[model samples]
Target: MSISKNLPMLSILAFLGLWQGLAFYLHSPLLPSPETVARIFWQHCQSGELPYHLGMTLLRLIVSFAISMLLGCSIGIALGRNEKLNAFFDNWLVIFLNVPALVTIILCYVWFGLTESAAILAVILNKVPNVIVTLREGTRALDKDLLNMAKCYGFSHTKTLRHVILPQLHPFLMSATRSGLALIWKIILMVELLGRSNGMGYQLHLFFQWFDIASILAYTVAFVGVIQIFEFAVLKPLDNLALKWR
Candidate 1:
């Protein structure tokens, strides 16, 4: 347990040490020392620049994620329950799932122009198919016996959904959300980089143009740290809640 607990810190220290050593060995201004990068990161934090960009990026993610979840789950439940509808849409869903995200994003940007709406839509397009596929499988696997039992007990559609279907779908919803969050955040960043005035991705693009490696690394670290916090605080709790019965 102690070894497991210490592993992350030890690995981080090792990485920092390696980075510092490489900077010293190379003796390049472009390759700043870890301390220098940390100092720069601190300055950005003090100025509140990092927090603003972080908040904006997170806002976009929340909007995109919420929209994707709503639409994806609706479509998934429909398709799962209706064979004809599923057969009709199966090919389209497969195509979207298999298409490259970059291509989709580029085409979306061209179609909608370089706007926030376009970027969010691009993220949705890239992420929704995944959620649909996952939830559809879950819906298809639901126990008909339990559903009939609910009907036998005179449960309404709402009641069945609330007490019967929802419980079975919870795990799949959690799985979809977990995977979607991991994927959509990165895609949103890519959308930001491709076109947008503000975001972590835009900042990273600006830093790259000037070859500011430290700032680039700082932005990346900041975003990754946020993702970790979300995983532990939000997704972990949801996963526990969903799997509690199991």
Candidate 2:
């Protein structure tokens, strides 16, 4: 079991070794060695720039995620529970889901004039439909016998949802969350690239102008490291804890 787990880390080290060998052979400024990138990444950390900008990006991710999940789950549950509401919103949901995220982001910026609200709103708009679709399916697939049992036991709406509905919906919610994080972070970077003054994306843009591949890679490594830590330290733990009842 330990060997299986360590295999991924070994593969990463092997890949980095290959990368280092290539950088040594090419000897190009454009493709700095991994050690060079790590040195630069350390410099940025010491300067405090990386921490501040990365924090900004993470904050946006949290805010937009909260908004989309709450609103989407509510809307999805309502639609799923009501045949008429589902029919009315079905096409609109399809429209939102099918719309390109870049188009939505650009439109929000145009209409809202490149403000923070616009950035967050664009992210929420892009993400909400996906959450809704997942949750709506979960709601639809809910066991009728379980619901009827709850009804027979005089379970209040809130109680029924908490103990019965939500427990069954856990898988769908987890699915939405995993996909949402994967998607929202990339879009957040794009949002920052297009408008924001500070973030990993904005910093990367500056590096791009100078053709500083090392700085770009440094930022990429630092930010992606943070994200990986968050996944392992936060998301994975929460997932395990939440699903432990099963």
Candidate 3:
């Protein structure tokens, strides 16, 4: 309805135009035209191959995201509330945070013998630290006055959490969630690429081996479209609702 809404479409069109032009000029197998990619994408969809692989990757992403968010938020809140605990685990968090994701994926595959558990574990390990850092800062920034008020009112821990603590932490939780989705999905791709028998990443690997550029781009575009849909349909609405109290 507005220019802001139209801008995304316009930009996408301009990108396609540029890509089409470059692709035509290059006439290269490495950089197939968008139309070629789209055609392959459609064929994959019609054959159900795309959906199957995409679903596998999505499953891993969802599981890893859930575990990372739950564990990270709980641990972050505990550490933020206890100075001694925070001090002790601070370096541990730093160590994990600084660990390269590729190395983690490789180690998990080596140690766990390329099982699904190891793949998911690798993704969780890689993502949890990021969530911890985000939520720890949020916990530290919580309103002391509100917490004291809840205490004075004889509120139970659960009640206080639901009414006073959680409301304030919603923004940070959303931040972790959004970042988690992005980060976990990527890690899952690497996990899939390294260890798994099936998924978008595995399919991409096969495509790479055959130098199937159009197929590779098709898978990438499809996954990105799915991510975009999720952000718009789920995360954005949830963010707006959660922050409405402010």
Candidate 4:
């Protein structure tokens, strides 16, 4: 087997063995064995309760990620093309980047009254700056020679963009998308946990209230599985496309 497949299997086996050993040695209900967590996950899956909560969380993540990408890319492209605009937004971007996501989410809840909109807005606000930063750097790194050649050839703006700028921007855009999506998904979950009523985060909070560690692990595993799917099915394919020209 390849190292990639072998590594994951080995890690999982080691984790399960350690969990079983710990549970036996400690003899505590506080920390459920891995088997117990798997059983809990299976039971919830059979009842479809896991899917309901997981689907809702994924929906919120998608919505927030979409909004962040739209606004972030627009602003990034504009600022990248204009030195004055870049300078103006630099300080604001710094402030947003430095601000803790939890604080931002709490402030949104306080300002907007603990609603789903507030949760989404918090996630968007936290995520957009990073995307902007990445794309802005990409914009700054664009080849002047390519643009000058396009100008020399008297290419139309649309043609120049399609043939020159877009191909150059693809790598940067792909990087920004992958990084932004990963960060935003986690932040969205945290925002949901802090302020919302229906999501994996809320379910985690419910599990915490009852000190149900197995259920918490079950939810964590389910969410993580979804993230892996996104990385493989969406991000990986896009990465391959973006780098194909290279």
Candidate 5:
């Protein structure tokens, strides 16, 4: 437990040490020292460029994530609970699960005309199938005894779902949520880099054009720091709250 608690800081320090050693050994401009990257990161934050791009990325991330979760959960629950619906969508799910994310993004941009809507839609399309599969398995694994008890007590659908079904689904929901954040954020970066003109991905693309390795690494470290903060400060607490009974 002590190891688990300190693991984040320890791992980060170990990674930094490895990175510093690599930079010292390679002696290449492409692999700037961590100190150089840190300097660049400080410069960008002072100039407000990093904040603006990061904010835009966060907005896109939130919109896409919310839509994906809402749609994924609803469809997943339907497919999970209904045999006929599951049968009907099983092939489609398989196809989608196998479909390349790049193909979906390109198709959405082509069909929807390169708008914000298209970018978010692309992310949603790629993510929904995974959520559906996870939740379906969770539904299948639900305790039949609790379900029968709810039925025998004459529980309404909403009440039964809240009191009996959802408690069992907490683990699956948490799993899907954590996975979704990881994936959707990455997809958002791709969407932004490929089509949109703002966000960290676009900034990274610009830096790539100029071959500004330090700036690229700086933005990368900054964005990842933000994500880590969210995971620890927000999602970790939510996970504990949801799954504490288990």
Candidate 6:
């Protein structure tokens, strides 16, 4: 096999080796060996507990991600296109952007109670501002010359949006998507930890109380692996497909 393909596996093995060595040297429960973590991971998978919690976290992530993206893109495009509106809303964007995510999560829970809606809203409020900032810049950076050409061709609004606007925004869209995936999951974890009854975050919190280092590492590895799989399988392919037009 090529070095590139083998490199990742080799790197992982090397990491496990290092972890095992460190665990042996420390001889502490605080740092478990990779093998110990793997055993706990497999046991959790068999018990179905890990999957259920993962699913709950995944659901919250998806719902919040979709809402943030939709609202962010719409408002960002509108503000980018209209100077007066942008000026009016600019402070609002800045305010939201600067607000601490933890504060937002706490506020949502206080105002709306510890419901799922509150959790989801906390995520959306935290994420939408960032998406708006990225997309607004992308919108402003759009090539006016291409826009004129589209206009000269008498492209309908829908056609222009699909064929002209979206393609130009692809880079920004992808940027928002990547960042959103990273940021939203963290916020979801915090939300679950603070208020929710079940999720990877809650499980992690439980393990933390028990000082179950192996279980903590196991769940963390599982979630990070899933995120990596998504980036490689879904995001990368979609990005490549989008770029083919260029």
Worst 10 residues of 1 by lDDT: 237-246
> Residue 2 CA error for candidate 4 (Å)?
5.0
- Clashes counted in candidate 3 amount to 0
TM values, all candidates: 0.89, 0.94, 0.95, 0.89, 0.95, 0.95
Question: Model 3: per-residue lDDT, tens digit, 1-246?
Answer: 698989989999999999999999999999999999999999999999999999999888888888889999999888878889999999999999999999999999899889989998999899989988988899899999999999999999999989988888988998898888888887887788888899988998999999999999999999899989999999889888877867
Error of 4 at 203 (Å): 0.8
- Model 6: how far is 109 from its true place, Å? 0.9
* TM-score for predicted model 3 compared with the true structure: 0.95
RMSD each, Å: 2.3, 1.5, 1.4, 2.3, 1.6, 1.5
Candidate 5: which stretches are off by over 4 Å? 1-7
Clashes of 6: 0
Q: Could you say which candidate leads in lDDT?
A: 6
Clashing pairs in 2: none
CA lDDT of each candidate? 0.91, 0.92, 0.91, 0.87, 0.91, 0.95
Taking the candidates one at a time, how many backbone clashes does each contain?
Answer: 0, 0, 0, 0, 0, 0
The lDDT of model 3 is 0.91
Evaluated at residue 110, the lDDT of candidate 2 is 99
> Residue 62 in model 6: shift from native, Å?
0.6
Residue lDDT tens for model 5, 182-206:
8998888899899999998899999
Q: Which ranges in model 2 have alpha carbons more than 4 Å from their true place?
A: none
Selected candidate, larger TM-score, 4 vs 6: 6
